[model samples]
Target chain A: MKWEYESPRKAYGETLVELGKEREDIVVLDADLSTSTKTAMFGKKFPERFFNLGLQEQNMMGIAAGLARSGKTVFTSSFAVFATGRAYDQVRQSIAYPRLNVKIVATHGGVTVGEDGASHQMIEDIGLMCGLPNFRVIVPVDSNEVRRVIRFVAYEYGPFYVRLTRPSLPNITSKDDEFIFGRGAVLKDGDDITLIATGIEVSYALLAAERLEKDGISAAVVNMSTIKPIDKDLIIKYARKTGAIVTAEDHNIYNGLGSRVAEVLVENYPVRMLRVGMPDKFGRSGKWNELLKYYEMDDAGIYNAAKKLLEVKK
Target chain B: MSDISPEKIRELKLIANKIRELTIKMVYAAQSGHPGGSLSAAEIFAVLYFHEMNVDPKNPEWEERDRFVLSKGHASPAYYAALALRGFFSEEELVSFRKLSSRLQGHPSLMVPGVDMCTGSLGQGLSAAIGMALAAKLDGKSYKVYALLGDGEIEEGNIWEAAMTAATRKLDNLIAIVDRNKIQLDDFTDKMVILDPLEEKWNAFGWRVLSINGHDVVQIIRALEVAKEVDGRPTVIIAHTVKGKGVSYMENTAKYHGKPPQDEEEYNKALKEIEEERREI
Candidate 1:
């Protein structure tokens, strides 16, 4: 089926402008990446409540904490590397320790950030943010889900980390779909094996499951958007139903959906699993699609991993 | 400066001495802490809590209350003493400092009643203060934001980033006070990382800079009062002080930078010196 593509950050920018209209206390801060992160949309509409902290990621996190403490639900934007990697200490001490009402909406996560190369790509952000307490992590599947995220966090108090991709993705999620925090949605149920994914990889996993059906294998696709307080119940439910599992993500295999699902199953229902993600290595200058394919994260990759895991079951 | 009455200075002096004495006792009771910095910042805490800031300890989260952040959070002994004196919490909790399950962690935590932000890691508080200042401007509220940073703590590059942001936004309602006691963890900051011409540095960053004797209650008050008048940009008060202001044995001694009195004789001598100063006031 043909699908329309939309940028998640673009949806984020539009939704934020709409939220700014209703909430008098919503403030946005950006660290010189507003243009790329699309937070410039909110800044242009609400200049008084917007702050461009100018390349100072560490200071921006600290400032975000202060704004939240003053009873304003603050949204901060920067690249994945700069927002989480550059200011880990600031985020830990200023935001996470006290659990302030600040949302960190970082754009350009994973190797899909393209010709900017490994320097701009941040596959470790999921692991970095998940390690912190009092933080709810989410990697929205599509533009519509991003819209739901913007509204959910605006009214919800406490710290949050929302990761968005650089490339625009197909709308695998529907507009009428409701987003429940810390819950996963089962797109397709299968009795043979389950495919768990997040971010832009959700679309890739869905396509992979479609192809798997032709090979006499039943594959279930799940969009595990909330990565920190992961849907343990849903994961365990599928683990009990399907004897084999395959986890896919745009991050490193060590700490992404793969590691989380493995941890959940190893404790509950042990199963044969293969993680489809970037191997623990760096990427060079290449087109985003080519880089993803070269790393074997496309439908071919998921299908191959699913076949191999099922073979191990035999 | 002359308009400020002598009686007011006397009362602030007494409070400063009490803060110094209380800081020594907290560190002594806990048997571990950064006493030198706490003693050095006693007068700054005294003036802010007693005379300068418009804060009601009973209503700490009052929307209109002036906000304060102890950016140099290792000086919690002085901070807790000032907050206790201002009637935020019971003075009896002072002995419970650094105990397990106590609100007072080794560094400042928001779990405490009057702490506005949690800041133990250096060079992060000024930005938090600026955030509060910016929020006040967004809401059109009149409350000012104050943050106290240690000279050593300012060595972290995050301080300069916050400095640029404050002036870039032209936050006149924000005031950052540097407890310039000249000592850091290892030795004097002058010997480690030179922050000299610190006044020119602030002026270059577009801040109105004020220099004063940090130990003098009158100077501390005058600088804070004058900082409120600064408009179009933030104000930074560089209050110069001794490593340990009240106690004789600990003064200028790097060993006491993060240590309490070792024996009963040293603890008694430290308390006696602070008590004598209070009596003189």
Candidate 2:
């Protein structure tokens, strides 16, 4: 399989710089973690438009909301944990309630923050941010998608939550491909089962599909990047077409991609679904690969869950 | 900044008294509202709505209009009362404060016309005000942004973060006023957390600091006028005030911070004081 090196965080940072040049209304804010979150690129290029609030996440969120109220398209960058949990109330009342045009671009999402431990790792951000009204939560599978979604969210005015990972991931989708913010992208075609995943898990879903293909199971792979909108029509169509489904994500099994897909299925399709994610537990300090293995968020785990669900169907 | 005349000052003082009376009546009707902070902030609220802010009650969302954020949002009674009195909404709506289906919540929300941002969480408003100021600079708009903070709420770290940003950004169009009533939810702010040397701290953070007796309408107006002329840095007016002004028994008392008038006798007494003040005017 061909793979390209692309950092989703860096891609986001670069895209923000481009957006800043094109639209004067676009301003970037970082909470003293710009170098880590990759928003330093935007800052270097547009010093006039960039603001560093120095590790004050709550204040940063409120400032972004205020900027939105003043008709400036604002993007605030911080760690996923701080962005979602630390300032949840600020995001809820100031930004979401007002339906402001602010974008929260959070990096180091999931256990992929590597040696930073559980304090920095955020597996629950998707759940927390998606629960908010008027908040569009997007977890891009690769760097190409991040670039696309930045532009998409800029054009679509409202509050948005973008989850980015630290480690470099495979660029499964090409730059030439057209990607929409709220719409899910289908990666592989199959009939027996549908494999739905988001963020870092999307690449894993593709690998699982490849493994399943060799095992003679024709599995369809869907990159469900936009968690909030969920592409309801696509979820319903695939769940009904395929009698079995498997969802993989670097998030909690509850209130994340799995829970949303289950919501769609239980209501309409009533199909058998298996959720492959971090079991109801927080991550511990370890290597990224070890953490992924421990949480059962890898290809083998996805393949095993798929087989288990197929067996249940039989 | 313009020079204030004695006549203008007298008119503002009358409006401030009217605002205090309306706030007391609204809180009494709601039966569960913050009256102390509301009463203390009445003068500043009146000055913003009646004289300072270029707001249109009919066009609440006018993009070019000046913005005012009640950073100390528990004092929303004063804001709601002032807005109603300013024709943003009907005075009848003031009776619905803190009710189940009322727009007048314990905290200020954007549901009310002329309310800029939904702020109740303390220390969050100044950051938003900075955003508005920065936006004005970016868009090349001349409209100014004003934010009011409670002395107690300044203890929250986010307010300092905003203060640093406002000063660093040199947001001259932004003016911040701290209602230094020296009292918070349960007790005096000195006992809670002494934010003394408050003016020096703001000045240290690169702001132009000014101190005024908040109840003195003329002094408050003069300070606000000076704040607009400062070109390079933000201005913070430390307005020292009594917690519960206008009410004889409630002044400087923490019990009245969150509690409304007890019975008809208290409400009548409060109204009588306001009537007497009006008669004096």
Candidate 3:
């Protein structure tokens, strides 16, 4: 199957412009990275609704909370590292604790931020956001999914953290794929083992499933977009059916997609699981694809992990 | 400036005294809370709630009502006293402060009526106020946002970031009153970290700076009135106050910043001091 590619940030920016046109209360805030985060697109169309907070992520998060309290649906953006790490306290206390209607649309998630390296790469944003109570964490697979997620979070009245990558992701889901909050999408169906993935790794999971199919193995692929409020029922259904699970993501395996899945599986149905992602270490300056390959988050890595997991199940 | 007559000043002073007495009682009952900053800002809170801010207790979430962010949220006892006196909640709720299931947490929570933002961490309220002010400007609302910051709390780098943003955005409808009480948790602010050039700093950041005795009801009212009159930029009134202003034993002492009255004797003495001050007013 042929695949298209689009930058998630670009889709997010374009979709925000549309959301702005539809809802007068939609407001955008960026911490001096409006252009990089693609929020500048919304700023261009509706300058009055956009706030350039100028390199102050901590203040930006607090301001976003205040705006939300004043009855405005606010969308704030910055690099994932700064948005979640630099201002974690503000996000937790002001936004999450209060359960404000604010959407933190962070870009440049994971090592795919490339060349900017360990300093800019945020491998633990999911873990940090998941720790906060009342925070909905989402990592769309591609540009098409990014558009839908943005629209969904805009209308939803609660605090959310949606991460986007810098590199253009291969289009996995079509435009018609409806995004349901707290639900996982079954991209492929099989009976042998389940491949659960999020963010850019969803496409790799699909490729791995196809490879496993050729090896006389049936693999199922589930796109777990919303990390928090995770789909427990779907996960249990797949665990009972597949008998084994393989979780993959561009983040560290400790507290990203893998940990979240493990948390669900441990309580409901214990199963043999393999998590394929960046090891417990920082990333270095390299090309985006190089970083993925080096970190063992590529399709080949997923296939190898799945192959090993199948052997464990047998 | 709005002319505050002598009679009005006397009424505001009594309100300030009530707030101080209640704040002392709340902290003493809880036996664990900040009383120094709370006592120091009683007059400012009294003036804002009674004279300056356009707020209605019956409608705490009124769309056009003015907003206040207590940045130095450890001073929540003072804030709660003012809110209760202004009829935001029953004055009886003051005793339940910092207790389990009490609406009055150790820090200010929006769960309490008339509290705009949840601010306990220092140096965050100013940014929230800037956000509210910005929202008002975008929606063409006439509501103003006021934030109160502690002298030591300004040491957080985030406050400067927010101050720079407020000035750059020209938030004319925003006013920040710094409770320059000279003492923090450990010692005087000057000994801990000098904030001597405070007024010059706000002026350099493009704010209309006003220096006033924070305990003076008439001066606080006048500064707030002046803050509203300033155009195209935010205003910051650096209010010089003594920590634990109403209690002679606690005054200018950092020991009472977070410590309650040591025992029944001290508590009684503190209450007597506050009552004597009220009688003088």
List TM-scores of chain B, every candidate: 0.98, 0.97, 0.98
Q: Score each candidate by Cα lDDT.
A: 0.92, 0.89, 0.93
| Model 3: per-residue Cα lDDT over A8-32, one tens digit each | 9999999999999999999999999
Give residue B236's lDDT in candidate 2 (0 to 100): 94
Task: Give each prediction's DockQ, rounded to 2 decimals.
Answer: 0.90, 0.75, 0.81
Per-residue lDDT of model 1, residues B1-281, tens digit only: 54778898888888889888888899999999989999999889988999888887878889999999999989999999899988999889987899996898889998888899998999999989999998998889999999999999988999999999899889999999999999998898989999999999989988999999998887888888888885898999999999988899888867888999998999999999988887888
Residue lDDT tens for model 2, A243-280 = 89999988878889999999988888789999998787
**TM-scores for the candidates:** 0.98, 0.95, 0.98
Please give the ranking of all candidate structures by TM-score, highest first, separated by commas. 3, 1, 2
TM-score, cand. 1 vs. native? 0.98
lDDT of 1 by residue, A163-210 (tens): 999999898878999999999999999999999999988888889999
TM-score of chain B of 1: 0.98
Q: Each candidate's chain A: what TM-score? A: 0.99, 0.98, 0.98
Off by over 4 Å in 3: none
Alpha carbon lDDT at A25, candidate 2: 85
Q: Which whole-number lDDT from 0 to 100 does residue B233 have in model 2?
A: 96
